[model samples]
Target: MVVDGTYAKMWISKGILYFVYKEIYEINRIMAKQIVSQRLQLQNENSYPIFCDLRAVKNAQKQARDYLAIEGAYMTTALALLVEDEHSMVITQLYIKTSNPTYPTRVFTNKEKALLFLQDYKE
Candidate 1:
């Protein structure tokens, strides 16, 4: 199943949940929560790894980041963040470190690498 939202699009493949954030004006808490809920439903409550393609995302609000981190701690088994540039990589790293996420997390510039990393969490 695929779900399209204002700033993100989500789908599931090989038992993994993927969310691609579009290049938009802003990303806030509400949108993040919506995406998470949609993803959870798509998986039918079973735990799964998540791959987030944030390469197109220009900026995200603090509230959105916080909400994702907190909620993801319980819902996500592992997280793979696909980032194209150094800035995005740094920002992703900061969030992971600050949030102290429960799952294993990593940042990669290539989608293949991200998917490969997330495969570890696949059952």
Candidate 2:
């Protein structure tokens, strides 16, 4: 299944959930909630390892980041953030370090590595 939201595009494949942010998009608290809600709807209450592609995101507000770190984790067994740019990588690292998400979360520049990390949690 695939869904297009205001800030991102979401889909599910092979027991994994994928979220790819729209190019140059900025995310706020409300947008964060909406994105999570969209994912929840797509997965239909089942948990999956999530692969979030943030390569196109411009910025995410602190509130959005906080919400994504906690509430955004719902129905997700693990999370793999795919980033190529330094800015996105730094932001992801900061989110992981400061927010301290309970689930297994990691950042990767390579898609294959990210998939491999998430594959372990796939059900």
Best by the TM-score measure: 2
For residues 28-96, what per-residue lDDT tens digits would candidate 2 score against the true structure?
A: 998889888888999898999999998888788989988988888888899999997767788788879
Which residue ranges in model 2 land beyond 4 Å of their true spot? none
For model 1, the run of ten residues with the poorest summed lDDT: 67-76
* TM-scores for all predictions: 0.90, 0.93
lDDT score, candidate 1 = 0.83
Question: Per-residue lDDT for 1-123 in model 1, tens only?
Answer: 688876678888887988888886677888778877777777787888989998887777998888888874566889999988888898789878888887899998889999999888988
lDDT of each: 0.83, 0.87
> Per-residue error at 87 for model 1, in Å?
1.9
